[model samples]
Target: MSLLSDPTRLAGLVTREVRTGSRDGVPTRIAVARRSYQTDPADLWDALTNPERIPRWFLPISGRLEVGGRYQLEGHANGVIERCDAPKALAATWEWDGKVSWMEVGLTPVNDGTQLELTHEVPFEPEMWGRFGPGAVGVGWDLTLAGLGSYLSSGEAVDPKEGQHVHRTPEGRVFIRASVTGWGEAAIADGDEPATAQTAADAAYSFYTTEPDSRPES
Candidate 1:
């Protein structure tokens, strides 16, 4: 088995939790993180606010990024920006019909770098929880954070195609494979069965790596 498959390594990088709904019916919560960018708050703010610069690091986002302005990614969900502050924070209601969800990204300046915090909240259901757990989203965030680091430090995007193609190489593959496996372990640690977590990780990795234009049938 690959070293990336090591359960301990995966667990070290993620934290998992399951919440029971309160009166408002809010239940599940998922958060993920990575360190090393040393992304100062000001620089991190630019990466998020500057339209020309957003795509180089994160997904190409198009929309008026003010509170209540509608936004869409070419192939991702269409949602309204729920909150925005120049370079420190953002939040949006992430939805697909009645399936309402929410995401928030915050930056805290540190002495050496910035700390990025991402929180995604979705209504919890037993079936969906079994399928996604926390790591499903956790691992994806890990990769995105890593990309952000590279972009901030080098002013160059880590080509997803190149990253996927050289996935078999020592560095590239290790990153991808470990991220996938780490997510699976996090899910299991959060109460999902081992087999279920593995399946979720496999499916998520496949979904992320597949070309956007050639998505597999749901």
Candidate 2:
């Protein structure tokens, strides 16, 4: 189901933070997002880790898939599994070309489901940061969680073509715009210049709404 066509349970989905920090002397930003699923923690964990179940919601992921192993998402990013603790947490090194980022996800049992929190740590590149701010990536996770929500709520695969088309629609554009704006607010909260942050959000909005390869979360 499309976010625009369907507005079911939106409370669990949120962009928690966009924090600027340093790791190993390299400047970095961590985008934190949270969402809940009406499913068991173990079931949610399976949806994330089990390659066969992943394509039903997320992308088609394939590789060694074990802890300390390498994995690749079809037509998307590839990474090495840094850590994996069942029904609790999973961490990986997200790499594209030669650039390396990190993604860590943790699951907690909620009243009738599970809360999934994801932290994406990105190395600061002046050009990249200046161009898109954190929304360049944050919105992708928003899309990811939204897709996951649809999947967990129903037992069917979300059509990628339909999803791509939805992103180009007016409603989808507004969603992306809000996501970019949220990231800009997050950047300002992290001490960035207001003007610069707004500029970045605008750039991000344009890219997501117009750029051919902007749908990175797919």
Candidate 3:
């Protein structure tokens, strides 16, 4: 089934949440998203950990994938694999552009399918949060989950370019809007003022939906 066929429904498949935490006395925010796939845990784990298959859904990954090893995502983040428990849980550092964050993925069996939960923890930046909110990272993961779903359904690779600019398409726009709204609601649930969260969501929505060459003059 094409994810774009029912973009809203596809976006709704994932549940998003936000939480606050402290890392070594520094405040942080965590964004969590959960989505279920029709495939079993083993298959989903293969799709996530197999270097040969990663580019089929997510970015092209290089370097070792085992615990204590470093891996790089093509043109994106590179980090150390801190923990790895096959077909169940994985944790890693997500570092890019001189900043570091933590990420964990857990897979659980659920009614003949698998539930994948992704949690991203980053030090809270007031400016960045006020500017983009959790949608900054949440929506990207939402897209990744959707791509994984598409790939698993057909066993075909997703075109990276099309996936990157999907928000420009009608269905893609709908998907992105729904994702942004979900993140905004999650932020509110995490104690952010509704107006503030909505403002941040608006910024995130524009960031994803605007075409590179079509930016309005400031």
Candidate 4:
């Protein structure tokens, strides 16, 4: 099934946050997002951890997903599972382009459904932070989470080609713009300078909205 909803509205469903922290004495930047799904915690947890169900919403994944196991997402990040608590939480190392980051997903039962919270932490890089801010990662997660919602609601796998094409559409552009703006506001609330954060958000929006075929190398 196709993603059938107002793009901006779908993007707005996520609550985004940005904060600063330290790990191993090094400063780290944290990006967090929360969204509620109209599904039970057990089902949501299965969708997240089950290899057979992951590609239906997110990317194609391979390798063991259990604790201490390494998993790779095709053409994306590869990671070692650090922790797994069934139907509650999962944590892993997110490695991409020689950079190491950490990601955790927490699931909680809610009145209407299940609430999923994702937190991504990475070593602070002044240059990269100034260029893209938290939106660099937040936007990607927003899209991924949106896909999850669509899949859970419609019981259909998201088409990879369609997912890429959507960003070039006007509605999809609106969605990316709003997601970037939200991340910018989150950074500002975390004590980042307003102007700098918004500037980085604009960069992120442009990068996301651009067609993949024409996108310049980072």
lDDT of 3 by residue, 1-218 (tens): 45577899999999999999989999999999999999999999999999999999999999987889999999999999999999899999999889999999999999959999999999999988988899989999999999999999888899887887788789998998999999999999999999999999988889889986775432
lDDT of 2 by residue, 1-218 (tens): 56455432242257468888889999898888887889999999999888888887678988898888999998889999999989899999999878899999999999978999999999998888987888878888887787787787777788888676666676777677777877898889988899999998998887778758544442
Using TM-score as the measure, name the better of candidate 1 and candidate 3.
Answer: 3
Error of 4 at 92 (Å): 0.2
Models sorted by TM-score, best on top: 4, 3, 2, 1
The candidate maximizing TM-score is: 4
Question: Which candidate, 1 or 2, would have the higher lDDT against the true structure?
Answer: 2
lDDT of 1 by residue, 85-108 (tens): 867788998766457677887777
Per-residue lDDT of 1-218 in model 4, one digit per residue for the tens?
55636887898899999989999999999999999999999999999988899999888899987899999999999999999989899999999999999999999999999999999999999999999999989999999998999999999899888787878777778889999999999999999999999999999998898867776666
Q: RMSD per prediction, one decimal?
A: 5.1, 3.0, 1.9, 1.2
lDDT, residue 107, candidate 3: 99
Clash totals in order:
1, 0, 0, 0
Order candidates by lDDT, high to low.
3, 4, 2, 1
Give the residue spans of candidate 2 off by over 4 A: 6-12, 213-218
